[model samples]
Target: TILLGITKASLATDSFLSAASFQETARVLTDAAIEGKQDSLAGLKENVIIGKLIPAATGLPRYRQLTVAVEGYKAREVDELDIAAS
Candidate 1:
């Protein structure tokens, strides 16, 4: 398994919003804007950042139904993800 420091791992996340909010705020946001990146808010951090409820099913067995906002969320994917920069 590859070992990555927490900061490194967070920085490497696919969601630019999560990365920008976590650390290196300016750089991450700048890079994301330049690249026209879109955040899917698929992870816990991303949801927390947007004040959205966590999906019931994140495919991680350990986190089943942690704080699901919508019932039956597992049946369909969220069509929209909030990507507002903080």
Candidate 2:
């Protein structure tokens, strides 16, 4: 997971700084998740929560931080960081 995260961060900081849009980012991420390139959106810890709503942490890292709350434990936070890190 960390690998993918680094790659994505690298891409954003080094290449897509001027061209990447949130919509585009979301689309790519979602597509990757749906396409099996990613394991699951349930692993990115930086944004995931097992039982709470992931607050809007603004800025670049937000796109990589994909948080998700578990079905039963909606109050806890789960970081699905493994989804795309590597």
Candidate 3:
């Protein structure tokens, strides 16, 4: 029935919009089924559907932290009037 609804919705309009709506519907249905219980890490859709951590980024074992350089040159302050006069 869910698949049928999704198929109909997809056919009725754009597939992308239908897909997003279907995902949201699936999430609501799944949440209702589990009665607000936490979802275990499973499929990508399930993780995303239930708002659990996705199986990418930090979930991966080989993930590395990125270091950013904070040091940079400071800009000199100039008056707007001086620039306009020039």
Estimate every model's Cα lDDT from 0 to 1: 0.72, 0.41, 0.47
For candidate 2, give the lDDT.
0.41
The predicted structure with the larger TM-score, 1 or 2, is 1
Ordering by lDDT: 1, 3, 2
1-86 per-residue lDDT for model 2 (tens digits): 35555446544432232113332666655655576652222322323433222334332346545566668865643344443342
Least accurate stretch of 10 residues (summed lDDT) in model 2?
14-23
Q: Give the TM-score (vs. native) of candidate 2.
A: 0.19
Quick one: best lDDT, which candidate? 1
- Residues 1-86 of candidate 3: C-alpha lDDT, one tens digit per residue: 35456555543432222344555667544645566544344545555554544466654434323333456955455443333344
Runs with alpha carbons beyond 4 Å of true place in candidate 3: 1-40, 61-86
TM-score of each: 0.57, 0.19, 0.26
**What tens-digit string does per-residue lDDT give for candidate 1 at 4-81?**
999999898889988888789999999999999999878777877777756545434455334546675665433223
Worst 10 residues of 1 by lDDT: 77-86
